[model samples]
Target: MTYDRCLATLKAISGREAASGYSQRALKQVFGTSKVTFPLSYDRQEFFSKSVEYSKGISISGVQEKLSLRLDRASNELVVTRNNGEYILKPSPEAFPNAAENEHAAMLASQKIGIETALCTLVPFKTGELAYLTRRFDRLESGDKRPQEDLLQIGGLPPKAKYDVSYEKAGELVDQATGGKRAVKLDLFRRVLFAYAIGNNDLHTKNLSLQRAVESSSRFYDKLTPNYDVLFVQAFDNTKEGQFMACDLLTDPETGEEEFTEPYQEYGFYTGYDFLELGRRYGLPERAVIRAIRNQVDSQGDMIELIQSSYMPEEMKREAEVIVVGRCRAISTGIDR
Candidate 1:
C-alpha cells in the first residue's frame, strides 16, 4: 500500500481514504484544524520571487533557504507574511537534493524514538515540489508570543561562533537554565544520542533552545523546546568529513583539550562507551542512560522502515539507511564498521 505524503501512514486510516493526500492525524498535527483542504497558492517559483523579502522576517539561520508564512484559515491557504508568521517554509536549496524529504523523515524518526519535536510535515508547492513546513511552537493560538532563547544567546556567544562550543558545555547550560532539573537533562542526553544515531552533524548551539512556559504555576518556567532543524546531513555528498559529531563530546576543564575515549582513538569515531561516559559525567541515572541507549539501538528496524517509506529518492533513501544503520551499530557496539 502507498503511504500518505503528510505522515507516511497507510493511505487508508481505518476505512476512510485520505482525499487531501494527508492522513487525518497529520492534518491535526500540522494545521491543528480539521479542514482537509488546506493548500498553498504559491509555488516554488513564486517563492523565489519573494524569498529575500520574506526571509528578512525570519530569525533563525541555517544552510536551507526559508520563508516566513502564515496560514489564512478563511482562504484555506498559506500566505507569505512579513511579521507574526506562524509557520516556517523551507524549500530544497539548489545544492541539497530532496532536503524536504530528508528533514521530514528525520523529524518523523525522532518522534518514533520518543524525542519531542515541533509539528512538521511535507507540503507541496503549487508546482508539486515538496517543501518542509514546521509550525512555530513559540506562537500561541491566542496570538501571544512566548519568550524563547537559543543556547548561543544563553551562552552569550555571537551567531558566527555557534560552532565554537562543545556539547558538554551545552549540557551544562541546560542544567543551569532549568535549575539542575534531571528530566530536562535526560532529554538533553537523548537528543545528543539521537543526533549521533542519525549522523546529523548540525546540532549546533543555535539549533537547541528553551522556551518560557506560558503558565506561571508550572514547576519550571524555562523548559527545553521541542526538537527542530533535524536532518541527516551526513547523507549528502558534500559532507564527507570524518567527524561523527558537530561539536566535541567533551573537553578537559583545565587543559582545554578535546578528550576522547580509548575506543574513540582506536575506532576513529565515537562508540557506545563515549556516550555512556558522557551520561555518567552529566550525572544521569544508570538505568536512564542504559534505557536511552537501548532505545536508540532498538530503533534500527523502525527507522529503516520509516526511511524506506519516506519521500526521499531511491538513491537518497539508501544513503540515509546506510548512514543510520552504521551509526546505530557504532552506538550499539564499539565497532565502527
Candidate 2:
C-alpha cells in the first residue's frame, strides 16, 4: 500500500496496511488494541514532566527517552501502567530533529535487505506528535520473558566496555553461540556489510543480542536476535570522522603484517574487499560474499522505493538515497577489482 502519515492509512508495524486505520483485527495481530494514547494535550514542558514521572521505575537503557506501554484494547489507547509492556515507545528526542522518523526508515531498510529487524511503526500521540513504536522481541506471547543477552554480556564485558571489541570479534562470539555454524557466521557477515553500506556506525556490542525460548531445555541453543536501534547516523551528522565504525573490521595496514588489528581503520570507508576479507575470516565462501553485494546492487531500486514511501522528510529521504546509492556503487566497483 502507499505510504501515508495517517495511522489508519499508514503501514502497520508488521509492514502491512491497516486499511481500516488500526482496526481491531489489525491491532490484535500486530499491536494489541488496548494500546493507550499518550497524554497528548500536555504542552512540551508538561509532556516531559509526565514522561519522566511515568518512566520512574521502568529501566530500559538508552540515550533517548523511551517508556514501556501496554495496550488497553478496550479503550484503543496505550497506558503507562507498571504491567509487563509488550511494546516500547520512543518519542522524538528534543535534541534531535526527526529522530523517530529516521529510525523507522532505517529499520524498514534493514528488513528490505533480508535482515530480520525489529518490527516498528510511526504512531501519533494524542497531542498529534508522531512517535516510533517497536514490539519487544524479548517478550513472548504467553507473557514470559525470553532469555536474551547482548554481545557485550555474551562476551563477558560490561556496558562500559561495549567499544572494547571489534565487529570481527563479535562474529567470534556469534560462532561460539551457534557452535561454529557457518550459516550464523554468514548471517553476521551480511549484517555487518549491510550496516556499513547504510552508514550505521553505531552498531556497538549492546545493539546485538542472542535470544532463546525460556521454555527450551537446551541452554546452548540461543540464536541471534532481530536487529534493533539501527539508524543512518552518518547522514545526519556533519563530522563523520569518528572512526566510521563502532569496531574495527580489518587489520591495520601500517604494521605491514597480514594479521588484522583491534580498532582497525587503515582504509577510510569500508570497501567490498573489507567485507570479502571479513567473510573469508569467518569461513564464508568468497563467491557468496560477492553474490550478496551484487544482490544488493540489483535491489537498489527496491530500496529507493521504500525510502520514497517512508515517513522521513523529503530532504532526509534524498540524503539517505544518495548515501545508500553511493555506498552500493562503491561496493560494486571495489568488488570488480
The C-alpha TM-scores of every prediction are 0.91, 0.83
How would you encode candidate 1's per-residue C-alpha lDDT over 185-266 as one tens digit per residue?
A: 8898899899999888888888899877777555443678999989888877777574778788987888877898888889
Candidate 1, run of 10 with poorest lDDT: 8-17
lDDT against true structure, model 1: 0.79
Model 1 misplacement above 4 A: 1-19, 36-39, 57-62, 217-221, 334-337
- Cα displacement (angstroms), candidate 2, residue 153, comes to 0.1
Q: Rate the local accuracy (lDDT) of all candidates.
A: 0.79, 0.69
Give the least accurate 10-residue stretch of model 2, judged by summed lDDT: 1-10
Off by over 4 Å in 2: 1-29, 32-47, 56-62, 237-242, 251-267
Q: CA lDDT of 72 in candidate 1?
A: 79
lDDT of 2 at 123: 66
lDDT, model 2, position 95 = 56
